[model samples]
Target: MSWLVTGGAGYIGAHVARAFIEQGIDTVVVDDLSTGRKAFVHPEARFVQATILDGERLVEAMRQFDVTGVVHLAGFKYAGVSVERPLLTYQQNVTGTVSLLGAMEGAGVHHMVFSSSAAVYGTPDVDLVTEDTPKHPESPYGESKLIGEWLIADQGRAHGLAHTSLRYFNVVGSGTPDIHDVSPHNLFPLVFDALLGGRTPRINGDDYPTPDGTCVRDYIHVADLADAHVVAARRLEAGDRLEPVYNLGSGDGVSVGEIMSAIADGTGIAFTPEIAPRRAGDPARIVASGELAARDLDWRMRHGLGDMVASAWAARKAAAPAAE
Candidate 1:
């Protein structure tokens, strides 16, 4: 009846953990604090500080918690950074997932929900990527996530293990006061910081083929993403016979320029961005078709871009005083 959430102290993972705790589910968290914060861990859940690569430690935690299912969220997620450090990305994301799967099998935990990414789809020729989209990952990070999904699918076919892999895009917004995002790589937080510091946020490549000439992406609220995980878990727990993949996103795309405008309007931070060349390996437009998730999991994003920006700005403002 209990679940093990890897990287449960991280931004999205912490939100998932909080949602489970609020529903009175017994949970266990395993994180090494590499990028996650101890402050994000819920007090009700048993917390274990360890990496997924440590098979012995992961097995021990699963055994101790009597974990019936797992929500796998541990991985390196930065596309540009992954290109610079391919080996490390593979080691942490790919190899770490392998170790975690091995540990799960050893502990007899058969059901899982994997935190995959739209990065796995890369830049598809089509505007909206479906579940059967061609996966031509551009960076090591994307390839690593694709490998993780393949692992889950293969394990499910070979063994009796059941899983749901939710591929998400541009996850934003806040779920709780104690679990706000601290990563410096993502767009929303970076823009928030630039405005807070009285500096113009840099926009890379504002001359793309899109309507506004800037890259567009689907920005789904983190809470809504967490809700999909809950639905996926429940379906598996209920023994629903289904395929293993679902895209979790808003079915709508927002341009980078649009996001900057939203931040300005929401936070009253008026600052133009400095134009820069396109980031290497960035797709011009990457949106999701969550039709499968909507049909099967009854999942829909309740919050729009405005809501996402406003809530993110709220969290940023609350944390700004301490950061000063």
Candidate 2:
């Protein structure tokens, strides 16, 4: 039996798919290519071009591939943009999850590892958020994710579906040079694009209450994040009990100012970031404690900030034009 990784062609999903393959687990990837790239999908994993919205197609894929579980990551993921596209976000994330669950039930595939987000804890008041943090999602994307978790939990209760949802913040870095994050809204890519285009990198709202007057967030390397998904999937497959949700955080905080410095150092660029006005709904700080994840899913920060930046920069540069 194989694992089906939805959105396996995207940055983080691709990494998860790669991790499963590396661990000698057969993997089948289903992606719509809306935001995911075909080239990012691992060569060893089976690829199916489809969206999670297509329940019938998903069922067919599970049966054909002999899928036993799913790593659900496909969705419209931009939190800020979700404000302008609530319907699209809900349709892709919430409704798509329903479709996937139905498909899983139909195909007799039970286990699921959902790629939830820290956005579910939007602007948490606590310094170090735990799994019990009160969810006050501020965006449609976050709402959809939280709702997806609820649906999954309900499904688990009703159908005995073994499942776990991983909630996380900024996912950075590249595990391999060929596979890198390409989200236009993500920090690493935005900074890399600025540097490559001979423009100054911009930071939003450097006048926060942080040590450096910038927002502080828990940034976990994408590789480490991907590994957690594999671990959770394996645990479920082995019939091990798991929490309904786990925060895959670094148990630390890194300010955006620090990230800018790291990027500058890693890229060998000497320039101060342009401080733009703080975007609306930007939280001053949001760090999480990955204690639960660490105990159960083998989650840990295997890469440091330097490694994260260096790897991301290298991958971004590799994807750049030859002249760059």
Candidate 3:
């Protein structure tokens, strides 16, 4: 039996796909290549060029790969852009997931690992968000991800669909030299680009209520995140029960100021980031406890902030031409 990884050409999806392949799991990748680079897909994995919205193609590819489960990672991921283009966001994340689930049902692929997001807990009031935290997603992107989780839950109730949704926070760093985060809205990429081009990177707000007067958020390494997904998939395959949701988060949290320092240290640059006015809807702190995931899914923050910055810089430097 093989696993179908949607959006396998994207950075995070590519890492998850590579992790699956390295672990000796049969893997097949289906990506639309809309925002994903074709070169990012793991060469070891079988690839199909198709969107999750294409039910016919999804079913055919699943069958062709003899897929037994799915790792749903394809979505319109930008929370900020989702506000401007809510329709497109819903279509990609919400409707796209619905279509993928339908195709999975058609193929009798009951097990799925939905790539949910921390966005589902928008501006959480609690210092440390747990899995039980009430979801109050702010943007259309976050709402769509929550809806995707609901869809998976509804399917599980309707049938014996063994599934789990892994809620990710600020995913950073690279698992391998060949793959790197390329999202324009991602913090690391944006900072790296600015620094590489001889521009000062700006922090949205440095006057928040946190210790460092900047936003505090969970940042997990891509390799560690990918490992969690692999273990989660294997546990499901082995009939091991898991919580419906898990937070792949850093319990202690790292402030934006700390991240800036890490970037400077990692890049051998000495410059304080420019502090711009606070972005709308910005929160002071939003760390999450990975205790539950650590217990069950082998989730842990193995890489330090310095490690994340260094590895990300290494990968970005490796792809200097495209990056510059």
Candidate 4:
């Protein structure tokens, strides 16, 4: 059966697309290239350059590809920018998802896997969040994602769609030399740029209540995250009736200082960082239990923080010359 991947040319989506290709699955990627790169799209998979907002085009693509399942990963995902452009975020994340679901329904594709984020927890009372955690999103980005998850859940019940929502936190690492983070908003790429440019990296906050007084996040390698998607897809294919929410993370927290230390060790670049006030709406710590994913999907993270940083550093160095 063929699978349709939305935003499959983007960062995480590209990696997941690679996983599907390696499995010999017939895959079709639909991306508008708004933020995705055509270079990241594999030659093995059919690529369609179109926006999901175009419901007719999306439905036509699904039918043309004979799509049996969909992995929804397209949307705007900048937390800070989402705050300033709330309506835009809602339109892309919420409205875009609705459009995709409609297309899927029309094509009779009932299985879906969504790329969600930990931002939905919004500084949960507990340090480690689970799939059942009450969502109290702090930013428009988070709110939009939460709404997407709710839409998937409600649609699944109302229309007999089987779906899974994987909530990820701090997705890092590189899958291949050619595919790297070109996004300006993510933390790892920003730090990589500063170090490669011989400039000091800036730490947003240094007074969070953590051990290092900095914000702590669970960093999961992108390859491992991609593997989790494969497993989730297999489970869906196996006809497992389950809830649609699962948290994918390392189940351990690493502070900003700790990440910088790993980057220094990985890149062998010794540069001090400037401490700045915390950005608005950043949570002190966000660690996921990941127990549900491990138990249900039989998934476990293989790479640690050091591996994540080292791989990212190598990819960053390779991209630097062209980035100039």
The candidate maximizing lDDT is 2
Instruction: Estimate the overall C-alpha local distance difference test score of candidate 2.
Output: 0.94
RMSD of 1: 1.4
TM-score of each: 0.96, 0.98, 0.99, 0.97
Instruction: Candidate 1: give the clashing pairs.
Output: none
For TM-score, candidate 2 versus 3, the one ahead is: 3
Q: Which digits, one per residue and each the tens of the lDDT, describe model 1 over residues 143-248? A: 9999999999988888788898999888899876565677888999888888888889989999898999899899999988888888788788889975688998
For residues 15-118, could you state the per-residue lDDT of candidate 4 as single tens digits?
A: 99998888888899999999999989989999999998989999999899899999999999898889899998999899999999999999899999999998
Candidate 2 local Cα displacement, residue 192, angstroms: 0.6
Alpha-carbon shift of residue 257 in model 2 (angstroms): 0.8
Which window of ten consecutive residues has the lowest lDDT sum in model 2?
315-324
* lDDT digits (tens) for residues 65-140 of candidate 3: 8999999999999999999999999999989999999999999898999999999999888989999999999999
Error of 1 at 59 (Å): 1.6
Candidate ranking (TM-score, best to worst): 3, 2, 4, 1
Worst 10 residues of 4 by lDDT: 241-250
* lDDT of model 4, residue 265: 89
The pairs that clash in candidate 2 are: none
**Residue 318 miss distance in model 2 (angstroms):** 0.8
lDDT of residue 317 for candidate 3: 90
